[model samples]
Target: QVTFSHCVPTIVQMLLNAKAAQGTDFKGWKITIGGSALTRGLYDQAKARGMNLIAAYGMSETCPLISGAHINDELLKADEDTRSTFHLKAGVPVVLVDAAIQAADGSFLPADGSSQGELVLRAPWLTQGYYNEPEKSEELWADGWLHTGDVAVIDEMANIEIRDRIKDVIKTGGEWLSSLTLEGLISRHEAVRDVAVVGVPDERWGERPFALVVLGEGRELSAAELQAFLEPAVAEGHINKWAIPQQIAVVSEIPKTSVGKLDKKRIRSEIARWQKEGSAEQTSLS
Candidate 1:
């Protein structure tokens, strides 16, 4: 079994090389990918090697593995696109667990799939409250449900696909761009080791996405290649052309919080410092 908590291309390459060296037929190998969004390219590569790949979805609050793809005959016989869609989806709710989407005002939305709202869950196993923090517990359950702090869109099949964190959605030029989406896309490139996408001030576009990339050791890639790779996605309307990011800065590493999530506050501070110093060499990517 192979898993990718984050979509690191080098790890994918290692898996492919190992598979080739083994020369063993992939009929029995089960490769399950989770944690971050899996790219179509990586999914296709694993499929070509005859490996059984599945997608799993969960979070730390849910004890992980809330729901996972079933390798049943029905799913196995599905078309490539269907399978890919399933792979991208968050999957159905597990038995004995209840989930719903709620608005900011604490009203539940209908399961119509078009409504965008915060995810609220009720599972028997979830923690009753934060340890030694009654106030925090009350705040978390203000609406009588476990507020997951995640924004998601459910489909007709009841598959909950996470869109972005409510706070991470950047409003630029009358549209919202998911930082998670941009990060996932940028991390797919071979040169990238770690990436963080954030919205920075723009005189024209209101707020534009900027990528802070930590390149893999000994790998060199230009900004033009990254732009070109994202062009097709823009053309396909997956994201706005303007959202393709105005700049890509190759940094040593991104600062992270103690919990390991990208520390956007630090990046914002760095950008401000650079702007104030008039550091043209470090600030300009083009």
Candidate 2:
């Protein structure tokens, strides 16, 4: 029998959910998940099916190996909830690399788990330039740190929790909200298999979170139900009350980029086109 195999979390998940195996044949299979944030929902689903999967975080610039959650005695002794919290993080930096979160003003933030900032890193093995693009290369290495552009919070234990991209973070009513956080919460619904949240412009609030969700096979859900599902997160203080998305649309699938990241730019453009067409229809009816 093959002792191990590896692939993206998405592919592993799809294989595990296949009807032929009845979810039992994949036991003890080893997988390395990367290229995107592996949400708790997918993690739990894979675990329940008896697959051994791990979360890793990095980029092409760093040669793609930064942090990985390796289960140890303490992690193995922890409860499911505790273990999931640790598993969901990007884990500590690997050997020879330095990672830290820095405030917008270039000040370093504490790794107490709540202070949000952009993740900056320095490593000898990291890529130097962008193929003759000196300006972009300079921007990438501004202040001698490789600005990853990823917004994250680091716990006292040094586990990195990626909150969202700096450009994707939603600012509405003078508050900054993490689209990644919202997407994670919404994916907890039984009917939701995947989700993507993007910030869209608003006249009154400056910007709002818009969600596109993919439902599980044979599952049905309503936008209001999805909104209701997130209401408790607001009360629990995981998110601001107003941070609950005003727009939750059920879609067959969320779009991804060439490297399998959520394509927010295209999504925003699509939403703008829809809003324009909707306005034209309303004007015609009037």
Candidate 3:
């Protein structure tokens, strides 16, 4: 009869793996995931282990409760897979929270699902300003909304799906590729125990995705194998062929921040250094 608990996706992954290893069932435990996006693969894994997961969106500046997934009768009628897709969204704004997307030009975007922009918020509980830091506070509260720095889309259902961090998006051939989306697709591979996808500077394309992967125990995978595995997704129009990483590194572990979020900055820096030093662990899929 335990109620829902809150955690980041990393904690959920660790718990799921540990409990499964110990032959323990989650007993239909409910977990509210925040701090980062929960991948579809992780959701599937948790469901298989008898865990119910819900995704949410917020930050320290907002008293940490901006939006949350809500299940309705219509949603309940959908298949588990379909429900999971909705469950993974950032969801409609919570009570007392006003959320909107702001374009680069400071105009509000429509809740059309396809219009992606920076998520902005205005809630009573949101922090007014940085303590004794007027300049920083002004920037944070610019245009009267708390900037979230998260690129997101709001569907007709008012479900807000975070596409990526504004800084982490990959710009290639004048199109944007979501590193989070790529990581989600890559996580579906059987051998990927842990993964991170980062955009690296490319002289030709402006930027290109690079993957760092950690394989499961007793599992082996190559860059070519991973590239081939993603081909079906490309054909299905889930991702563009150019979105595939031309190079991948099979690593013992992917870097994480002190708070357990993927450390993309560090990952990018490591890749740059590795490329300069010519690491033997790096593989060329192209």
Candidate 4:
């Protein structure tokens, strides 16, 4: 009975699960996904269910408007495979919003689609500061631009593709790994119902990626199985072998924030506690 909906990627995923359980037809649902990165795996699943899904980008600070997946005449005429390449991106900035990527050295990076850095914005509608929080406000608008805290890259067409959050990006073996990318790849597995990857402290590598996964009903998955599944991605140079999670635990649930985004902070604490108590299933490659 729903014609249109606007929600985060998590909500779209939940709706897909509901549709499967209820066996309902959603051939004409127009759903816009915002608030977080939309993975290709989720997009494919939603498409298979006949849901018309689109990706968007914004934050509470920007009056919740910035970019979206633009489907123009050419895009509309293209096949799903061709359309998804553009649809999965954050798209060009909306009118009045100037977007840029700032590197760690404070230099503005190029919009070459490969230079990843913190996404900064300048728009008339952006929030100026936190209420009664001068220090935080100052940080938010450092160098006269609102810092979004999201690491992203911009292509020649001005499309923005969010890579990962600054705090959540994993630094292992002197290379940065996008947790979002890892999760997206993991979610492609047929047995994976939900997945979250976090970087845990490691002595030799500085930090190692750990994954927590939830399997579909009556399905089973193991760390070895997942690594085997991801081998092709590594072979194809989508990710390095070291980027493969050193540990994976199948859990009944992955915690979520009030708004339904994955609660990575709580997940980190849970992993710590689980390791301390020897309850976590430790699956590591030799």
**What is residue 147's positional error in candidate 1, in angstroms?**
0.8
TM-scores, each model vs. reference? 0.74, 0.92, 0.94, 0.94
RMSD of each: 4.8, 3.6, 2.7, 3.0
lDDT by residue (tens digit), candidate 1, 191-280 = 776677888777876788878887766888778888888888788877778878767788776776664456777877787677687762
Q: Per-residue error at 101 for model 2, in Å?
A: 0.6
* TM-score of structure candidate 4: 0.94
* Model 1, residue pairs in steric clash: none
lDDT of 4 at 149: 90
Can you write out model 4's per-residue Cα lDDT over 194-272, one digit (the tens) per residue?
Answer: 8899999998998899998888889998789999999998998989989988798888788888988888999988888
Clashing pairs in 2: none
Q: Return whichever of 1 and 4 wins on lDDT.
A: 4
lDDT string, candidate 3, 56-148, tens digits:
988999888888998899999999878988899998898888888899899999999889899999888899989999998887888789998
Better by TM-score, candidate 3 or 2: 3
Clashes per model (N, Cα, C within 3 A):
0, 0, 0, 0
